[model samples]
Target: MVSLRAIVEDETTLLNALSLTIPEREELASITHPAQRIEWLACRLAVRRLVEAQGVPYAGLQKDEFGKPHLIDSPWHISLSHTTGWAAAVLHRSRPVGIDIEPIRDQFRRVVPRVLSDKEITHAASDLNRLAVYWCAKEALYKLYGKRQLTFRDHLHIEPFADHEDQLVGHVRLPDHEEQLMIRCFRTGPGLLAVAY
Candidate 1:
């Protein structure tokens, strides 16, 4: 099983407290933008706590160009996700991984045409759950790509699936990389779908 942990900070104040507990808190706290600072703190704290729990050092954490986190010195692969008042990270000693959590809403449907192929939209149009599966699948791909300048529709493609809310099949169609990605979706709360790859 994949090792995953989630922390929900109901308020900005609580999130700030968690951020200040990280060793790199001072450096991140210096960031001028509030959003950036909070994100930085959340990512650092989550990774650090995970590493420490596993009896590892903070130096093991590393960031890639796309800001994907990896373990430089440890044997674990890691993925991170966050939303309004929640932050989550997963670590595993084997297998590349990706995680994403999104607040479920009809807004996702409006954007579906922009990110999904005509075939995909035709398949998912009737079902809200299926649409969310597609959204989360593409999002997982985006997190894996860890780079900018990717068009969700043109560059990423997810195979059409039946109207099932629990799972979906995704395919990444980038020029040099084409991989079948499996996506598992869960309702973490009233209007949220959390996916992992």
Candidate 2:
């Protein structure tokens, strides 16, 4: 089973404890991008804490060329997500896994037409809502594919859904595989839109 949780602090004690738990913690800590550094550390901390309670060791984690995290010698699969002050991860013993979280914003409108197909945009219950769903779903699919050549519009497609204020459903279509994805959108704080995949 996989669990998700939100970390609200940037304390070193928590970060160090997480580094000690995950096998690839040292590697993640080496990341220098300010945003990446914070998220990588926070996510590592959350995943380690969750798996350790189940008797899993942090040293069992590894990452791919795209920097997606996975279990080292163990067979379990893992995925990480972080947005602003929050971080989350999922662990499953079977199947390849991917997860993403984003802070939603109006800026998505500027990029929506580039990624969404005409059919998808038409099906969007509202213009703003459509773009938000499209952005998050594409991000999730990108994380799953774990490759650089894929373009959100040319390579990925998402089906539109009836928009509610807080949740939406869509299907992510890739060149090789198609899967249904669920996106939950809500305000996490002032001026922040959060999407979890």
Candidate 3:
């Protein structure tokens, strides 16, 4: 099972709203862009909230060599995603998990060829909502893989589903190994969230 949470707030409320370790403070300082810093803070605070909800001490986060964030001193696997003003996080007890949030936009139409495969493109039919779902699903799959070698069009595949469906099938195809995962979608405030595990 996976637990998910989303946080939406203004810049002032999020600033210094959560406790940070020395390393986390330094990491925040290293981020130069104001928007990026806000995103970083929001994601950390959101994930920390999830950790505390489970009655566990939030020891902060650590990234593996592949850049996947893991809960320090805990057995939970975690994934995070943020866009503009929304940040989301997912946690699973014993399985790798991925979650992505994205707002539907016209730009998905332009990036269709780059993000979706021929089969997926045919299934999407240039619809913005479908394309947005595909994008979020693939991004969740990519984060689940937790490696940098895969491409959306080549390695990650999401089976076609009907409009208004909340569940879909996703496959991560590699040269030597392949695994199928179940993906769940939710209608978040102004966007869609896809969770793969």
Best by TM-score: 3
- Which residue pairs come into collision in candidate 1? none
User: Best-fitting candidate, measured by lDDT?
Assistant: 3
Cα TM-score of candidate 1: 0.75
- Model 1 lDDT, full chain set: 0.65
Q: lDDT by residue for model 1 over 33-145, one digit each (tens)?
A: 76655555565567667777877766645567666767667767777776655565666566666777767778877888688888888888657777777777788767765
Model 3 misplaced stretches (Cα beyond 4 Å): 1-15
Q: Which pairs, if any, clash in model 2?
A: 21-58, 22-58, 23-58, 23-59, 104-193
Q: List TM-score per model, in order.
A: 0.75, 0.74, 0.91
- Candidate 2, lDDT over the whole model: 0.62
Against the unseen true structure, what C-alpha lDDT does each candidate score? 0.65, 0.62, 0.85
**Ranking of candidates on lDDT, top first:** 3, 1, 2
Deviating ranges (above 4 Å) for candidate 2: 1-6, 20-30, 33-36, 165-197
Model 1 off-target regions past 4 Å?
Answer: 1-40, 193-196
Evaluation by TM-score, superior candidate among 2 and 3: 3
lDDT of 3 by residue, 1-197 (tens): 33334455555677657777787778889999877778788888888888888888788887888878888888888998887777788888789999998888998898888889999999999888899999999999999899998989999999999999999999999998899999998877558999998
